[model samples]
Target: MAAPLSTRPVTMVSPFVAGGTNDLLCRLLAENMGKSLGTTFVVDNRAGANGNIGTAFVAKQPPDGQTLLMGNSATHGTNPTLYPNQPFDALKDFAPVCMVAAVPVVLAVSTELGINSVADLIAYAKKNPGKLAFGSSGIGGSGHLCGEIFKTATKLDMVHVPYKGDVPAIQEVMGGQLALAFVGVGPATVGIKSGKVKALAVASSRRASTLPDVHTVEEAGYKGVEVTQWYGLFARSGSPKDMLDRMSAAAKEALAKEEVREKMLTQSIEPTYLPADELNVFYRNEIKRFREVIQRLNIKVT
Candidate 1:
């Protein structure tokens, strides 16, 4: 028989470094879920290889429901296409637990560029061609894919500069070292509010609540540019159905709390919860979507 849920502490691995959106959400959800499940949830930061290191570690762990992964778009959706030889299969190696949240991608340009809107940026890019450049968190990240989608949709010939993370990329943009950056709302909000960068559009179906003035990519007259960074929970494959169900229940309960929702919203993260079965479908569709984007852009990890 499986060990009692409370017998041992649960370890949730955040593949990215600490202090990132993924890590923050993991800790927040883990805290609340721990309360709900009457167990301790510890966060393990295993940062490397764009989240592959920690993900592979979890994939190799025993599927006893004691270990889980706090996976995001980079790990589950884009890495398969970005990496030539992945150590773990996102779908085959894990069982979906629940989806945590989604954050919109903000298309911000250097204030020195004097570009006020998406139209202005597109016009400038068309006129300058290869002279324009955009930065991303990394090569295989959602920000990079968003830049590619923007290039494809607008038919712009801009160069891509990959950084170690969004903060550094945003810093480059602020310093006029880079022309544009597709960044998450967390960092982008500070830049936008401080006037260091100008937010032209958000790559989401709707405007982010935090950036009320920024228009959606579609609203800015650009189609097919919808992209958002999503976080989810997963466990090694072959975990017990009861364990998965219990975890999912705890996640849903935690998300439904007003405090949790407010805290997530304050960070410009939409607190979203999807059950295990639905999350599986959503995860597969996201992987397919990213695969198509990579193929269309001919993106290969260096």
Candidate 2:
């Protein structure tokens, strides 16, 4: 792929500001990927709309392989159900380039609460009924959805507390005003390490290596409670076949590199690169899978 026509620089778009985990990961890979292809790789931050704004921006860009989108679950899988008029269709508006990585969402509770496990949390919710309040980053966010799923799976009654972002939600939880939250490992790792929060379980099929002592929701005897924070790459549908193939190969090779693998591991993110066609299969299946949850919960924007 690095022939005479490989002089064009690739532009990568991230939906969060600099210093965020997404931005950091993209920046880290840019160096290696850029060197591999003999071209400049730049990360553009287009933060807003909970990632929709940046995603839509990239979705509308030309399918020239130069402009690529670092698509997350929120922008690609969950936005359709969350926003009534999502400007871009995750499946229709873009071409799947590759999957970057997957992070685990950990369920944690304030130490003052005395809840040590998923069963204990359910028991406490049952005992208190609507008294227990849980905070999330925002309505329809992954944290909120995780709580909703938990309530439905356990058949418990708990109040939903939506916050502006994870910062305030985590503050309230630490202050003992909010009992629990399913927080991203990026921010929650520090607190978990400092003993500020007690981790109940990870919301994935397997336990995270970062918290080997903690069990997964599935291991807690709860059926059908798997979740992951997945991130991937995409370009507008009709991107050049050769360019897409070349980029996909480069991405997979980068993931195999020790530096990329180590950086992802530091954030508790497991790097797994998927080819373009396989990513499309995943995107379609995720849409269908989440729709059932949204419908079952009667979740809507209005």
The lDDT per prediction is: 0.88, 0.80
TM-score of each: 0.92, 0.92
The residue-level lDDT of candidate 2 at 130 comes to 84
Cα shift from native, residue 244, model 2 (Å): 1.4
Predicted structure with the largest TM-score when compared to the true one: 2
lDDT of 2 by residue, 197-293 (tens): 8889888878887788999888898867766778888888888888878778878889999988888889778786778888899878777777778
Looking at model 2, the pairs that clash are none
lDDT of 2 at 181: 80
Q: Which regions of candidate 1 deviate over 4 angstroms?
A: 1-5
Query: What is the Å distance of residue 60 in model 2 from its true position?
Result: 2.1
Give me the displacement of residue 238 in model 1, in angstroms.
1.8
